[model samples]
Structures are given as C-alpha cells and as structure tokens.
Target chain A: MILTEMMMKVTPIKNGTVIDHISAGQALNVLKILGIYHTTDATISVLMNVTSRNLGKKDIVKVEMRELEVGEVNKIALIAPGATINIIRDYEVAEKYAVDMPDLIVGVMRCPNHNCISNTDEPIKSQFLVKNKNPVVLRCLYCEQTITENIADYLI
Target chain B: MFEKRHVLSMREFSREEIDAVLAMADTLEPYAYGGNCNSLTGKILALLFFEPSTRTRMSFETAMMRMGGKTLNLGPAEGSAIAKGESLADTIRVIGCYADALVIRHPKEGSAQLASEFSPVPVLNAGDGAGHHPTQTLLDLYTIRKESHLDELSITLLGDLKYGRTVHSLAYALALYGAEITLVSPPSLRMPDQIKADLEAKGTTVRETGDLNEVIEEIDVLYVTRIQRERFPDPREYQKVARSYKITTDLLKKVKDDLIIMHPLPRVDEIDPEVDGTKHAVYFRQSFYGVPVRMALLKMLIGGDDID
Candidate 1:
C-alpha cells in the first residue's frame, strides 16, 4: 500500500485555535458562531471543502491569538459535531480534543420561538436542552419548542 | 412536593404529585365557598396579568382572599410599568421583593417560566399565550374528580384542540391517569400531532374523529373549549370552525345519563343556553372548582399548614 503525504492548505498558527474537520461548507457558520466577521481583530484563515481520509471533504478554521471559549465550542458542536479544536502554541499542538456537546446549553443560541422570553429585551440568556447530537436537535428549556434543522441559524 | 416550587407546565408533574394536589384540593373545598381559612394570611400574592383575564385573575384573587391572604394586582398592561417598557425580569424582580408568590398571565408563551427565573418567590403560571395553563388543568381535574371519576375515564375533548391551551394541558394530564381520550375537532382544528403522539407513547388509548355524535354516549366527560377568534390567523377561518361544534340539548339527549359537560368558560356561543339547564352541564360548577384548586396550590406552595 502506498500512502501519499497530504499538504496543509492553511499554515499552522503559533498561538491560537485550529478548528478542524468541520462539516463541509460549515466553515462560514463556524466563523459566525465565533462572531468573526471582517471587523474581527483576530487574524483568521478558513479552508473550505478540503479533502481528507476521514471526512472525505471538510473545512478548517485557524484563528491567531485567540483560544475558543467553552460557549463558542459548544455552539460549534451543533453545526460541526465531528470538528476538533487544536490549541496551537509555538507552532505546536498544545491541546487537542473533539468538541463535546453539552447536555444543557446556556447563552449560546437564540430560541427560534418569536414569543419566547429569551427573544424579548429581558435580561435572560437563551437556553436549550441537547436532545440529539448527530442531526443536532435542541429543545428550548422555556417554551419546549424544538429546533431540528438549520441549527446554526439560531446561534447567538 | 410542591413547596416553594414553580408550577409552570403539566409536563413537569408526575401522577403522584397531581394526585397530591387533588387530595389537597379536597381538604380545602369548604373554604372555597364561604369560610375563614387563614392559612396564607401573611403571604402576599402578586397578580401580574399582561393579558386580559376574567376567571383566572379573579380566581387567584378569590383564592387568596378566601385563604385570608391579600393580593396585589398589576391591573392592565396599559396602566402598569410594563407599558413604560420595563422588561418582565425587572417587573418580576420588583414584585418578587413585595410578594410571597407571583401569578402571571402574559400574551407571550413561556413568560411565566421566564418570570420564574427572575422571581425570588415561586412563580405560578396563570396562563401564557397558548402555552401550558397547569392550574386550569388542575382545576379541571378537580372538577372531574368531583363530578365523575378520573379512574378509567373516557373523555371526549371537543372543539378547537390545536390552539386551546386548556385542552392541551388537560389531555396531557388525563393521559397521565390513563384516560381514554376521543378527540373531536375539524381537520384544521384537530389536536396537535406531537401531543397525540406523546399521549399514544404513554400508552393512553386515543381516538381521533370529526364527529362527536359517535363517541358522545360512551364517554365519561365531554370537555369543550371555545375556538378563540384571536388564535386564528384569518377571521373567516375562525368563523368556519367556531360554529362547527355547538353543544345543544338535542345532542345531550344521546349522552350517557351520568355524563358531565365542562368548559373553561367566558364561552361565547359554543354552548346553547338551552343545554345549560340539562343535568350534563357541569361547567358552572367546574368554574367554581378553580377556587378550591387554587387555594390548595397556594397553601402547598407558600408553606401554609393544612387547614383541617
């Protein structure tokens, strides 16, 4: 058997997070969850639809000088459940682990229910119970409304 | 089990807890009529109704007064700080400081659950849009227990099942007691698929049909809910369904001799006045049961001792 060396599309970051194995075409959504737009201060690179032996085709996001927060990582799990976060320090993998979906998600995403209290100007963050992981189903803790599709569309 | 707990939804309750509330309600029945029970004497209940209410607001107030407790009313949304654009959290916090418990009715779904998060005291959901009205369900259960038997109850829930919050909670609660539910509604106004599925999953016998005449004679209770004009997106659609299921004396002739009819009233024309004279009309009595059921809830939630 012949194993060909794979080339890295995006250069490794010295001190930041490298989110890899994001579901194909979800790189932008991951960025949206991270609140990283053109005005974002963190230097970032997003590689979309990259070939891989594991995922066939995947997306990768590298952010310079910023480690992902626990809330951000949990939100990423909704959109890219198979994704892994590698903390890069001095161009070396410092910490690497797959995102674990939280049983109770808090302050991470907006509930789609228009009449939900979380949608009002009240001082309360949205909450959801993770009912399913693969297809990413969420049940709002307050209204009991379920979100089964387009999970990223509700990211806070 | 209910002490200092928020009564938000019927889904949160178990059969034992529901039975406990019903048992407690039985003990508090005397005070509901005309008696002095100072169980909740020192406890001040705050009534925060962002929506218009007749029975619920008055029921809570009557429950508190009957128990020798005072109530603070927020009146209408037009007159309250809510009109000044204060958030529900702030309103709850401010009222929580003054009251021992808060009973809220809002136009938005899940408002009481949201208020519970901010309230220092326990929050009781009176009604929240088309969401759960657990107390109403409790009172309905209490009425059923008094007028009929919850054991092996065969109930036919008629009228607007889709948007009727009372029927939704009642159906779920009845399912807990293993009631055989026959749902009668127009196709567009039928019980929600999710609720029907949940009921069936719980091993409750559920039958759906458009005709109430087929099931009227066999059922133990007929729970009717008004098809609200506000719940419909179109007035014409509302008019079409609103007139589809009126209870008349002619229909009552076919029912079982002991069968009782109930509605969560402020009813508009769904029940003919002629049927009000029939033995089957227990709705007026059903309305009265709200007082005792709420009294039991107040006593249980606010650390009030057993009156007797």
Candidate 2:
C-alpha cells in the first residue's frame, strides 16, 4: 500500500526532495543528514517505520521547498545504503535515483581514531575508502583504521 | 617513477612499485657496499628528526652522502624551534626551502602526511608514531627478497602487532605478494581486527595465534617486533607479555635450517644475543640493505629518470 493512501497522516511536498526506502529506525539519522530540527523553517514531513513493498519496513522524508545537496545524498548512502532519493517538482516526481556509495569518501566524516592525523591541528582532510557498502565499512586513508559500527556518531 | 613523489605509507604502493624499488636497490648495490656512485651530486637532503632514531636517521644520511649529496641534519626536537612550540607545518615549510627532499620521523602518527602537504619537496616518511613506516617496509621487502622469495612464503609476525607500525606496514605489503601470514601476539597486542579482515579479503591466508611454539615450525620467515613499553597505556599490562616471546639459539635449532629471522632492531631481550651467531640472524645484514634501498628511493625521488 502507498504511504499517502494508508497513513493519511502527512502531506506531500510541492517542490523539493523525498528520501524513500531508508532502513527502518533511521529516519532521525536522515533528519540529521538534512540538518532538520524543531526550529527548522522548511515544511518537513517524516514517516517512520512505514510499511513498504520494496523494503519490509522503511522511512520516508518529505521536505517542502528544500532541495538536497550531494553531500547530504552521500551521508544518506552511508547510513542507509539502499535508500532512494526522489526529487519532486510541483508535487510530481521529476527525478529519482538511489544514492551511490562512492569508493573514496572525502571530508564527509571524521575518522574514529583519536590518534589519526586528521584529528590533529594540522590542515588535513579526513579521507576514507569504502571497504564495504552494506554495513558502511570505512577505512581511514591516513591511519588505516577501519570503522564498522557507530558510523552515525562519526558523522561530520 | 617516484620523481617528486612523497612516500607516506606502504598502503599507497602497488606490487609493481615495490618491485621497482627492489630492482633499483639491486642496481645500487655497489654504491651501498663501498663504491662511490655520486649520483645525487648537487641535490641537498634534509633530516628532520622530531623523535629519537638510530637506524633510520643514519641510513638516510648515509644513503644521500654515498650518492655524493649534502645533508642538512636537524637534530631531535628538544633543541629545535619545535621545543618552543613551533608547529610541524611551519617547520616543514621552513626546511622545504633549504633542501631538495625531506625525511621526517615524528612521534605523532600522520605527521609525515601533514609534512608532505606543507613541503615543496618530496617528503619521505622514516617513521610516524605507530601509524606508518614506509621506508622500513621497503628495506624489509629488500631483505625478504634477499633471504627468501617474496611469493608464497609462510611468514609469522610475532609480538606487539597492534602498535608496531612496521608489522602493520609489512603485513599489507606481504599480502600483495600472496604471503601466508601467521600473527602471534598476546590478546592485548593482537593485530587490529580491520587489518586482519582486509588481508583476508585480499586472499592472503591469515592465521591468528597466541602460541609461538605451535606456529614456529610452519613459518619460513620469522618477523618479530618489539613490544614497546610506551605503547601500553598501563605499564603493568606490558609486564605480563614483555618476555613471553623470546628468540633463542635453542629454539632456532628446532626450526627449519633455512628459516630466516628478522627484527626492526634496538632489541632489548626479545631476541637473545646468542642468536646473532646463528645463520638464521639476517637482521644486521638486513639493516645494511637500508642504505642501498634508500639510495634507490632518493635517486628516484630527486635525481633524473634516465638510469641504466
């Protein structure tokens, strides 16, 4: 069943982005990526743990009059690898595609290693090589520390 | 191909690049031994040692001098501007103006990578805290090639696998050549889970063990690293495993006659002095290879590309 037809709980956006198929329980993280808070001025609608035919359970975020940036897409891909990004124009789906988990992630997140050079006062950007995409395993390019869990905590 | 290139980590090198370095080292053997090559005549090399080092500092200084190049030696951090709280970037930028190439050894991991950015010249990482030591790994490769073949050798890396940057760098490099590695360290100092996983994914057979006697005979090359007193957050924890794995002459008798023993030295008690007389000890000879290997690297970095 479609989200709008079943819930009748939230309204759709006129022109903006709709992040769909986010893994269940990650809607808050998606909001974190979008930098949304209670004080956010943009009209935002969040559907948590909604029933989806594509995924067993998914989260959908609809933001009115707010377009998504490339960094936001990359952040979404890291937390929720299988999520799809939908661009809506005039309440119509204009463009849609799943975010690609890039092989080399530059400056999107900080390395978990406390001793990592990127963490130092030196002017060096944290770079990571995506070792695995499903669970979002990232390896630090400089220190070579692999981060598998608590990835959301390390978000930039 | 290393012309004006900064060697920050062994992870940055490919198998072909490693072979290129080994081949160049072989070509520069005469210059390393006693012959005067004088290839880097007009070039100036800088030695910026923020930490104390014996082998690495001397080898680089010797490598450049043998090639007829001059060296600007910046002694340890205490007497320098760094003691007065000068930043690494400022120090590197200042030294970059004085030399054609810079070799740095710092206590902080990733300082070499940071130095590479600030310097106009190529930056060579002599050693960087527990992060990486690319030059040591190169010399290890050179030694491995000299003693045994780089391919399909069962190598055991024992002791302090966690904080030993040499083991970390070597493990990655050896995996490139399809070496079957057996890592033996105490529970506290085991190989980092990520490195072991990455190596396993790369098709290198990795075995983790806490016992040295069980895996000793199976190893063709015994690569040992010292369990550093400083690496342990608690000194009492280091005491538990400090003398656990020692290489003695009696133990070497039980192993293969051709089994090669290697160490990144400044040995305390991990390797007994008695083993030095045995044919198994190749570490001193291994230490000597650093000069030629570094000479090859210096030539590649600073000198022109037309080498015969």
Candidate 3:
C-alpha cells in the first residue's frame, strides 16, 4: 500500500484549528501559548521542522475539536508572527487567515518586570504594547519595561 | 489642556503640550512664592508617598496649599493601611473618594501608574522606583528654561543614568526641545542603551563620555545626580564611582561662562559646598521651581478654566 505524503504526515482533523507556517522550532511554545500540555483531552498533532515552499522550514500544530480564540490567536502572533490559522470543519478548510499581531495585548502574558504594577495585587491585568512584530518585543504598559527575550516563558 | 489628565510619564506629552505646561507655570509663578491664589479652593489632593521624599512631597503640598487646595498625605508606609496588608488598589480606591486628584510616590516602579488605574480623579506621579518622575522632569525643564535657553542648548547629564529616574525622563524631554545631550557616567551606570537609542532614533544628537572635563567647557547645562549607594551591589564600586564624579570649584573653572549646574537636591557629596555660592549653582533655585511647576500641574488638573 502506497502511503501519500499527507498520510505520512498529520492526518486531517474533522474539526478544529491548524496553525500552519509557525516559525520552525516553535510548536511547543505554540502549544504552551494555547495551554495545551500533556493534560489536554483534545487530540493534538505537532509537525515540527516540516518543509514548506513559503518558509524553508516551519512548524504546524493541529488540534482536534478546538478552534482558536482571539486571545489564543494574538498570543500565537507574538511568538510566531508569520503563522497562518486555518479553521477545519468536517475535514474541509472552512476559513483561513494569517495571524495579525495586535497593537496592544492585554491579559495574555505576565510582564517580566517584577516591579510592574501588573505584578502587584492590584485588580489589573498585564498589558503590553507590541513595539516590534518579527522577533517580537513587548513593552509593558505599566512599568514601561520592554520584554524582548524568551517571550514564551512570560505566557500567563 | 491638562484637565483630568494623568501625568504618568514624560513620553505621554508632546513638545507642544510641554510648552503649554511651562507657559502655564510662568503665569502661576507669582502664586508659588508668597502670592495667594484660590483657584483650587475647595479641591482636595491626596499624596500617597510610599517612599520618603523631601522636594517632591513638600513641593506638592506647597503647590496644593498655594492654590488654596487641601492635601491628604499617606505619610509613611509603616503608619498606613498598606502595612496592614491592604493592597495599593484598595488604598487608591478609598482615597480617590476623598480627593479631586491623587499624587503617588512608591518604592515599587509603576506604583503610580497602578494607582492611576484605580483612582477616580486625576493621578500625578511624584516618583516611582526607577521608573518615571514626570513632575520632576517638568520642574527640571522649568529650571532649564529659566536659567538657560532650551533652543540648541548643549547639556551634560552626569552620574547614575541607568538607575536615576530623573535623568531617564529628563533626557527624553531635553531631546524633545532639540537640545544636544552628553551623558557622563561610569561604565557600569551608563544610560540604558534603549533610552540612548530612542533619543538617537528621534534625530537628537547624543554623545557619551566617561570624563566630565571632555564636554564641560562646551555645554550650557550640567545636570548632576548622586551616585546612589543603594543602586550598587558592591560598596567599594559605589565608593569608587562616587569619588570620581564630584563637582568641584576646580571643575567649575573649566565650564562655559554661563554654564548652570543643576541637581535634584537632597544631594550627597556630588557637589562641593564651595561651588554652591558660585553663579553657576542653580540647584536651590531648581528646587524652588518645583513649587510653581507642580502648582501649574495641580491647577491644570483640578482648577478647570479659571487658570486661563
């Protein structure tokens, strides 16, 4: 029996989200951003360092029975700015669009600034302004401290 | 233009807005010293100083009093409900009810920004730990404009640039007025690279030097800040940096004839007592400018159209 490249790779999900064209080596971070760890009940397929025509190499995360939310999509844009989100319904692509980085991000990640007001017991969520998109840099709105390194670790 | 506005950071103000505030400060100058003004007559200002301050606290109080506005001070953290484990948010919310404006200075960076969110009225940041002291920057600009011209002026910012919140805000502001800046500091306490980059990105001319003598003869303003012993991890390193940066009468001899030396006072040994008597010393006058600058701010925040 001849196995097609599609079968050799990830099988189609009847319904859910396919995050494609994620910058290579960022699938785990994408899962972490999506709050999908080993405890998740949803069937997940992570294809890392897969060859792509647009991107020489990319990572893809496919989740069964779950569609991406606005906040999740925004979080993904911070880590993988060039990623594309595809909504899959009944084994067919229902909608597809590339993730657009938000001008302002609220409550999505904890500010790395320990002295930031967002880190205090105040009834406020962490807020950041996206200063740069590619190799994302977020400036904390409270402390004015910029977060440029290891952004995934700051995920809420 | 400033009614009900939050003066959180110098970055929030444009050049035009800064000019407007300074212009208002000029009009309010007479009221700051001895003259009576009741513009803010029944208004109440709440001052929450989680950190100890001399100039900032007193000037804010004087500013409120001069405008006939009452002030409520949160005196010390140990004496307040903050020591009883009440969050800053609750404190701000409670005080916001009693005051027309809230002015906060906290040891934690962004504390004022936090209070502004919960505060029902306008919030003014007196100082936040190594974060922003917008009013200080405003007063510094006021002093600069009073003593020296801001147009194409050459200024040198000396001492703890990295941790000195005043210099951080002042640099951006001075740059906004199109002044050329020279930064002098020990290598360890150099201005944060990001701030220098931001200044340069805005087409401001910024130069760096380790020795004050390198640019002292050429500059018009010399802004000095203490090499804070608390900011250094090592005592010996702090001592070495502090010793090397003292402003002396000997150093003043080489400065430009009209060069004005300014320091946000409660200064340590950074400036010699002998230098204070010289025409160059404007630190005391600089401290005095704080009153009118803050008065203009308070009047603008709560006093409404009566100021114009």
Candidate 4:
C-alpha cells in the first residue's frame, strides 16, 4: 500500500516539542502564533478537521527539526487547552506538556474581552487565574472575564 | 483636581472596583435626590459629543456640575469643529487644552481610543458610536445589585446583542460577578464572538438561543435591548429579525415574580410599555441612576476617596 503525503507516517524530530490533539480546525491558528507553520530547514505537517475519538473528530500536527519554547507552546494552550505537547529525543519521549494553567497568565492569551488590559498597546499583558478542574478554564484576572478555549492556548 | 481617564467600555473595571464605584454612586444618589453636591470645587469637564445624546451627555455634565466642577458643552455637530473635517484627534487635542477632563461621544467606533491618545485630560467615553457606554454598565450593575441582591443571578439578555454596546459591556461586567448569561437574540443579532467565548471561558454557563420563551422563567433579570437599525448590515434582514424578540407583559408569566427587566433605552417596541407597570421593569430607575453613577465615576477617575 502506498501512502500520500497527508497519509504518510510522520517521523518525529530530536529534542523538539510535538503538539498533538489540536481540535483540527485550530491547528493552523496555533501554528501561526507559534511561528512553526513555515520553515526553511524544517518540515511542518498539518491534518485539519479530521476524525478522532477524543474530539468526536480532531486534528494533528508533527513538526520536524524545530524546537518549541514554553512561550510558543502557550500560544497553543490559549486556543486549544485540551492539546498535549510531547518532547521527543531520538524519537523517544523525553518530557510531556499538558497545558499548564498559569495562576496569572500575562501577555499570553488575548483577553476575550476586546477592551481588555492587553488590547491597548499599553505594554501590559492580560493576567488570568486557572479557576477549574477536569476542563481547566482561564479567567482574566483584570477584567474577570473568561478567555475562550480557542484563545486559551496562547496565554504565554 | 480631577484627572482625565478613558472609559470606552466597562471591561476597564474589576468586580471589586465596580462595587467600589457603585458604593460611591449610592452616596451620590442622595445628593441627586436632595440637591446638588458640588464637591469637585474647581474642576472642568469638556463635553465633546458629535452625536446628540440627551441622557448620557446631560448626566455627565450634571454629575460634574453637582460636584462643583464646570463643564464645556460642545452643543451640536452642525457648528462643532468636526463639520469642517477637524479630525477627532485634533478636536480632542483642542478640548484637552482647556478642560481638566473630557467626556466624549462620537458616532464612530474606536473614536474614544483616538481621543484618549491626544487628549491631555482623562477621556471618559460617553458612548462611542455603538461601541460602549461603561458608565451605563456601572449604573446597571448598581441597579442589579440593589434589586436582585445577587450579582451572580440568572441573567437573560434579550434583543440586539450584535450592536447593543450596553449589553456587550454589561455582559462582561456580569460575567466577572459569575452571572449565568443567556444571550437571546435573533440569529442575526447574536453577541460577538470574543464576548461569547469570554462568558463561556469564565465559567459563565451561557446559553445562546433565538427563542426567549424557553428560558424566560429561569431568569432572575430579563435584560431587554432595542435593535439599533444603524447597526444592521442589511436593512431587509434587519426588518425581519429586529422585532423578532419582544418582551411583553404576557411573557412575564413565565418569569419569577421578583424578576427585574432592564433596558438601556431609546427603546423601540422590543419591550412592550405594559411591562413598565410591573415591578419587573427596572429600566426607568436604571436610567435614573445614570446621573449618580456617572457622578461617582467622574469622582473616582478624577481622583477622590469616594471610589470605595
């Protein structure tokens, strides 16, 4: 059996973060904010609006030759809180990252409130509290409004 | 001296800060009822309104005057600097020079941000087009707390969420206090994306439905809003959905006996006049609070111990 580029098995990179379980539609949104969507020496694969068990249907992305920093990983966490990041070395799991809910996330997630503290170019980041369990929620500490799940992964 | 502040939206205040403002408003309410307070002594508030606003513009001016502050009213747009293509920035700069603070209402969105950039004084946003009326939110919050006795009550937001800037600002204020918000509008006039996500993410437990009958009884406060024809994309479409949801007295049968109905007025048929007779209607009293609540805001933003 032959596999196309979309269907082919993706080989993991050494010492880079592998972000998995994005809600298919938000993969590119995550990539744009993380700056991993385009690369010169790296390969970026994205599967969008795909079928999955966890999400009833979900999407996946495997980036080769690029390492993701905590700040960049936060971009994904803002939008897709359910997303999981796995650190790979020699195609072996080195560490795992389940979106860490920061007690006060500043300049990370864009406050769902447009008039939020972060919206003004006023050199201040939005702060939020991780208020719940099971499905973690980010509450804007300043405005006390909720940052949407779609915008959650970005709270760096 | 009263300093300048930009109050484009209610999102500027926190739950506690809002409460503080309300407390101050309670103090101002007495002054309004008895007579003028005139505590500001010798400050000035510049009223730069391109659009005609009866309540808000007058309220702020009155608030400042009662506090012993002077006001510069930019009466109408016909002869105002804006008629001659004088930019908002330029006008704000002009106003910022003489006044200690600015209270502005322009017909354009984001005009307040632009004004705040140039205005030397703190720019209190009166109402920037269909954008926001933060002072109104403060009063609305004050009214809800007084009548409902709970900030986190079951709130039903009816009518035009798309352009009802009051509702947009109020929703976030309510969300901060942990209110369960149900946005009821025709599909065409639903709440904006950022706000919807804001409510859901903050554990607001929001319900977005086109129909109001299903949830009218469950609500503690039925927040009615008028559909602004100016905010519509297609006039034909506006005609179809603008009046789709109306809160009549008969509809209150499903509501709690103590349910409070509110509207940031200049209302159309969205709320039947019959509803006004019932205790459920707080829109009038809510509208009345504009003077004192804004007085409290002007005092706080201008630097006063009255904030708490």
Q: Which stretches of candidate 3 lie over 4 Å from their true place?
A: A1-10, A36-43, A48-57, B1-4, B230-240, B304-308
Best by DockQ: 1
Q: Could you tell me the lDDT of residue B49 within candidate 3?
A: 86
Which consecutive 10 residues in model 1 chain B have the weakest lDDT in total? B299-308
Which tens-of-lDDT digit does each residue in A52-128 have in candidate 2? 89888999888889788766686688888888888999989999989888888777678877877788776567888
Kindly list the per-residue Cα lDDT of model 4 for residues B1-308, writing each as its tens digit: 22225666676676777777888888788776647565676788888887888888877877887777889988777787767777666777887999888988766555676677677878887876656678888888888987885555999898878867788888888888888888888877788887799778888888889888889877899888888777677899777775567677777777888999888888887888888898888999988888888888787777533322
Error of 1 at A84 (Å): 1.6
Isolated chain A TM-score, each model = 0.86, 0.83, 0.87, 0.66
DockQ of 2: 0.47
lDDT of 4: 0.74
Docking quality tier of model 3:
medium
Worst 10-residue stretch by lDDT in candidate 4 chain A? A147-156
Give TM-scores for every candidate, taking all chains together and pairing residue i with residue i: 0.93, 0.84, 0.92, 0.64
- Candidate 1 lands at a TM-score of 0.93
What does chain B score (TM) in every candidate? 0.94, 0.93, 0.94, 0.89
Per-residue C-alpha lDDT of model 1 across residues B119-232, encoded as one tens digit per residue: 999899998877889999999999999999999999999988888888988998999889999999988788889999999999999999998888988989999888777877
Question: In terms of lDDT, which candidate is stronger, 1 or 2?
Answer: 1
Model 1 chain A: ten consecutive residues of lowest lDDT: A1-10
What digit string (tens of lDDT, one per residue) describes model 3 on residues A1-156?
Answer: 998996888788999999999999999988887778758788999999989998999999999899887666867888898899999999999999999888898887898878777887778888899998877788888888888888878888
lDDT per residue, candidate 1, A2-121, as tens digits? 444433455557899999999999999888877786597778998989888899999999999988876678678888999999998899998999988889888878988898777888
